[model samples]
Target chain A: MKSEKQLVELSLKDDKHFAELVERYEAKLSRYIFHLSSLDSASTEDILQEVFIKVYENLNGYDTSFSFSSWIYRITHNEVISFFRKKKARPQAISPDDVDEDYITLIPDDTDIPKELKRKELAAKVKKAVLELPEKYRDVLVLRYLEDKSYQEISDILKISINNASVLVNRAKEKLKSKLTI
Target chain B: MSKLADKILKKVKKANIKHKPRWQFIAKRIFIWSALIVAIILLSMSVSMIIHQMTVAKPVFSEHFQKREFSPIFKLVPYFWTLISLLLLTFAYFDFKQTKTGHRHRPTIIVASGILVGIIIAAVMVSVRAPHNMEEQLQRHPLYQKMHFDKDFSKGPGALRPLMKSQANNPLAFPKN
Candidate 1:
């Protein structure tokens, strides 16, 4: 398999190759955009398109030192931020219906909470809890657990130091724990 | 590819989006840095100029104390420069934030650093420019000259005498020497 860097190089030369790059990342990035911003699918798609276009526009500027996925995620993060700034509103809450078993399993277990709760019920509560979080904490949690990005990758994507990113994740988890406990 | 991806891919082709040449990115970044540097320098100059003027432009201590009414005075020019400089520094700060890797630090840290750097530069520039005798210069202006002679100078034949070139030598009142 060609590496992501090779694909970026190839995409620079051939537009069709860029389609392959888009196909490679679209689903993961889309799901992330949806969860991270609680944006509706159409707005998420528009922002995603802008992100890809921005990626193509600055392909030569991509630093080899960073992972390609981190670079893409950073662009998407910027676009989402810009989108919210232009709209001048807080991110809308995600629908509980958007929660799935993956996220349900991803949630950290609480011993105090009843272990007998069904997956669906737990998922719904988790979904609402995640949505109620402040944007900073929510972003860290989404990138860390939902997108399964490393601390370094989250730092790169969010343009924060690795220590700060780790601190943020811990804080976010604490916030989530508190929310879920209630 | 999914339908949305296909549509975006098609749009990408139609947009004729291509990799910006490496040199272009380099050049753009250089330009932004240069602009930021210039803005910082200008901001420093503005601040230092204001500080220097304020320190130097005061009325003589004896004259100020002797006066009965503490007449309110307005001098907008010095503060106007300061305002402009602050505005430029603000723009430069935002520009710096937009640069690649610019977002790594907290904004409060960035602002505090920017201000500290600006003050350091202002200190250096003010020392170098050292506007000596700005107080004397302020005292010799036409407005002050009219005030020295009382408004009657402007209302009477003295006004017809045409302003003297050696206004700098004129004193409002000779101090005990």
Candidate 2:
């Protein structure tokens, strides 16, 4: 398998290679869109399509200094924000059905959860609490925890300073802890 | 391929969507960088001019203070240059933020650094008397003299009327003893 950078170079020459890039990122970006916006699969697909089209159109503009992943995530982030702006509504909580094993890890260890509560129950509560937080804090938490992005990557994705990224993550975690306690 | 990817691919193919030309992106990057550099240069020049005016007008300022005439002191300040410098600094800040790694820097850092850099460059320009030369060049322009000197003579401090009168005759003879 070619490296992503190599694939980008190939894609620049031939549209066929762009298909591979799209395939590689489809599942990941789709999940990200779903996680950020609780849009149904159809809406998610539509957003994902727009994102890919934009990525293809601006492929030449991509700065190679940053990771391709961060660049793509940034574009997706903008698209999601645009989606919300157009709809004139804030993001709703992630549906309980979408809350899965991955979200279980998002529950901070410091939280004094009762031993009686099952993992799934705890995960659902955490998801709801997280999505209920302010959009800025929620974005940082999702990117930091669910997306497993580094501070630098989060900074790039969100167009914030690295220090700011770290600060937002800490604040988001604190907010989540308070929400869980309530 | 996944169904969504397949669908997107089909749509792209049907639409004949192509990557925007490389030169357009390059041109945009160049334009941003050029604008940033120009803003910084203009900011530095304005700061240098302010410094030059302050330094040259130091004797006048002291003379006013000694007499306890405080109102004219405010007039000695280079408000035009100061405003220009501030506007350029703001422009430079926003332009810097548009760069690829610019977002990595905090606003305070960018602004502080911009001021620091502008001051450093302005100091260099002052050392070479670039602002003084620029003033002299502008004074040579009939419109500049008419607009600037006429305003000063009409509303200037009585203490500096003699200096302005001499400057009007010989623009380079600013600090007539």
Task: Output the number of the DockQ-best candidate.
Answer: 2
The iRMS of model 1 comes to 2.6
Q: Which candidate is the best by lDDT?
A: 2
TM-score of chain B of each: 0.59, 0.83
| Tens-digit lDDT track of model 2 for B25-106 | 9998899999999999889999998888788777767877899977767767777788889999999999998898999998
Listing every candidate in turn, what is its Cα RMSD in Å to the true structure after a full C-alpha superposition? 7.0, 3.4
Off by over 4 Å in 2: A112-117, B66-69, B136-165, B168-177
In model 2, what lDDT does residue A3 have? 82
* Candidate 2 clashes between residue pairs 3 or more apart in a chain or in different chains: none
lDDT of 2: 0.82
- In model 2, the Cα lDDT at residue B49 comes to 85
* Two-chain DockQ for model 2: 0.69
